[model samples]
Target: MRTFFITALASILTFPVIAGTMDIRVLSDINLSSLIVSPISGQYAIMADGQPVSDSAKANIFQLILEGDSIVMKTLEKKIGKFAKVIFTGVGKNNIIKIKSVVPAGRIRSYDDHLEVSVYAAYMKVINKVDLERYIAGVVEGEAGGVTTNEYYKLQSILCRTYALSNVRRHELEGHQLCDLVHCQYYRGRTTDADIISSTAATKGMVIVDGSLNLITAAFHSNCGGQTVNCEDVWAIPLSYLRSIKDTFCIRQPHAKWKRNISTEDWMSYLALKHKYPVEDSLSFNNAVSFGQAGRAVYFKDKDIKIPLKTIRGDFQLKSTYFSIEQRTDSVLFRGRGYGHGVGLCQEGAMNMTKLGYSFKDILVYYYKGVHLVDLASLEFFREE
Candidate 1:
C-alpha cells in the first residue's frame, strides 16, 4: 500500500511536545468508524484515555487521504497497533451527545483507554497540515456510505486527536519502541484504512474496562483447557484485570492449515525432542498440569516444574499466562496459549465482549475494578500559557 504521512512529531515522547504546537494533515485509506466516540482519544480540547487531550499534543501525522471510501496512511516506521475514532459532533449546529444522561461538549473516549493505531510504512515524507485537511475534505465530498462532507470534516478533527493520543502512548508511556519490532506492539496498517480505522471509529470511545477501574489488570490466554484459568495462576497485574477465560475470536492456531495425521504421541515427540528437550520414553504431556493436580514439585529431566510466584505475577506484559507440562502420548508436553505476558486487557477477550450484549463499558468494568466517566470539557480550564 502507498501512503503519505505529514507528522513531524516523534512517535514516542512525553506530552508538552518540544515544539510549540506544530500541526499537520494526515492521509489514510481506511473507512473510519465514528470518531466522535473513540474512548482512548480526545481532541486538543480533550485528552486521550478519555481525559482532556492536552492542547500541546499533536499527531505523528495529520493525514489527508485524497482518495475514496478508503485512504492509506503511511509512516516512516513499523508499529504494532494504534487507536483512533471519527468525531461526529460537527463544529456547530446542535452538536451534542449524552454520556450517563449528561450532555457535554461533543467528545467521547473509547472504553478502557484501549485505542491502538499502527501504520506500515518503513519510510515516508511529511506534508503540511492545512493542505492535508483540505485534500481529505475534498475526497470525502460526495462518497458512498452516506458520510456527508461535514462528517468528513469532523473526521479530520477526530483523527487528528486520535493519532496524537497514539503517539503519546507508543512513544512516551511505552518508551518510544517501534510497535512492529514484534517485542513491541505490532504494526498492521494505518488507522485510516477501511477495515482498520472505520470499524474502530464506529465504536469510538467504547469502554473496554471500567467500574472500580482500580489498576484493573485482568488476564486471559489463547486456549484454556476448554475452561478458564484460575485467577491467581494467570494474573500478573492486580485484581484490576483478573477475569476468567474469554473467547478472543482471534483463534486460528498455528498449523491449522497443515494436513497432519500424526498420532498425538508423535506430535509430542516432535514438539519436545525437536525443541531440544531431552525426552525419555516415560515423558508425558499430562505432566504439563501436574503442578495443579499434584503437589510434590514436578520435574522434567530433573528441572523443577514449579514456577516462582513473582515470575508469573503482577505486570509481565510480554508473555502468555496459559502454560503447563502435560503428559502427551509420548514425551512430556510443555505448552502455553495466549499472548501479552498475561497482565491485563486481552485484545481477543475484548473482541468477544463486542459479540455479547456488553457494550465497551461493560467489558471495561468486567475486567478492571473502579473508575468513572469524567467530562473532558473541563479541560478548557487547564490551558498552558
Candidate 2:
C-alpha cells in the first residue's frame, strides 16, 4: 500500500497543473451610461451584493445602468437596484457571456468565464475573471491575429504568457490584475481561430524567463528592417536577454520601408525650436541634417549637440530611428526602415522562420538571447494547493 501511494504521488508531480485563472479588467477606463450583457451559451446565475438574485435564471439578456452613483440591473423590464456589485457566473463549460455597451452602438464583446461589475459614479466598471489559458487564447489572437502559422502562434502564446505573468499585478490598485488595453495586453474577448486556440493550448502555461528565473518583457514589433535593437536603446533600461541582432527575414516585409518628405525650412525650424540647434551654422547643421545610416545610429549626429534618434523619431512621428537624410531641391527626404520600437522579437521575421519550419523554441532563441522556456504550471506559485 505504501509503494502504491508513493507511485501515485510521483505520477501526479510529473504532470503540470492545467487549471489556473486570472482577473482581467475589461473596458476599465471607459465610462458608459449602460451596458447589455447576455449569456451566449450554458446556464448562468446573476448575483447582487453576494446574494443570489436568481438561481437558474431563465432570462437570456440583462442590462446594467448607472443611476446617480448606483447600479441598476434590469431584465424583462424588472429592475433591481442599489447593489454594490453584481456577478454573472457560468454554471457549465459551454456558458459564455456577451457584453455590449448600450450607449455606444455596436460595441459588443464576449467572455468565456465570469464577469464582475460595479458602479462608480456614472459608469460601470467590469472585470472578467477567467481561466488563464482561456485568457491567453484571446491575447494570442489580439496580438498576432489569425493569419500566421501554428508555430508562430505558439511563439506568440509564450510571449503573451510571459508578459501576463510578469505584469499580473499592474492594475492591483484599480481592482483587477490587468486591463483589456494596449496599456496592458490587448485582449478582445475570445478567439474563434482554431490554430490560435490549438497553439495556445499546446503551449499552455509556458513562459520565457531569464537565467535568474525572472520573466522577460517579451516585447515584439511588426518589423525590424534588417536588424533588431537593444532594449536599452529604446527604453533606456538595459536588459541582457534583449540584445540587438541582425534580421534579414523581415527586410522585404510590408512595414520594412517607409519615407516621409519634410520641407527643409520646416525641418530646420523644428530642430531650432525643439533642440535649440544652430540651424544658421552651416557646418554643424549640415552635418546633422545630411547624415546617412549605414547602421542604426544612437544619435542623429556625432557632434556634441547629441540629439537622440529616439527623440527625433518621436518628434517627427517617424516609423523608426534607422533612417537616412537626403537633401532634395526644396524638401529633405527621410528614408526609414522598420516599424515600431525595435526592442525584441520581430513578428514578420518570426512568421518567416515558422514558414521555414523552425520550431517555436528556435524562433524564440533567435530573437531573445539566453532565455529559457519555463512552464508556469511547474513553477511553485502556479501549482495547485
RMSD to the hidden true structure, all candidates = 17.1, 5.1
Estimate the lDDT of model 2: 0.83
Q: Counting only residues 3 or more apart in sequence or on different chains, how many pairs clash (N, Cα, C under 3 Å) in candidate 2?
A: 0
TM-score of each: 0.36, 0.92
lDDT at 321 for candidate 2?
89
Model 2 reaches what TM-score against the true structure? 0.92
The list of candidate 2 runs beyond 4 A from truth reads 1-19, 381-385
lDDT of every predicted structure (CA atoms):
0.30, 0.83
lDDT of 1 by residue, 165-274 (tens): 33434433323322322222222212233532343344333222233211122232322322234355433333434444443433443311111123456544543554
Report the alpha-carbon TM-score of model 1 versus the true structure: 0.36
What does the lDDT read for residue 264 in candidate 2? 92
How many residue pairs collide in each prediction? 107, 0
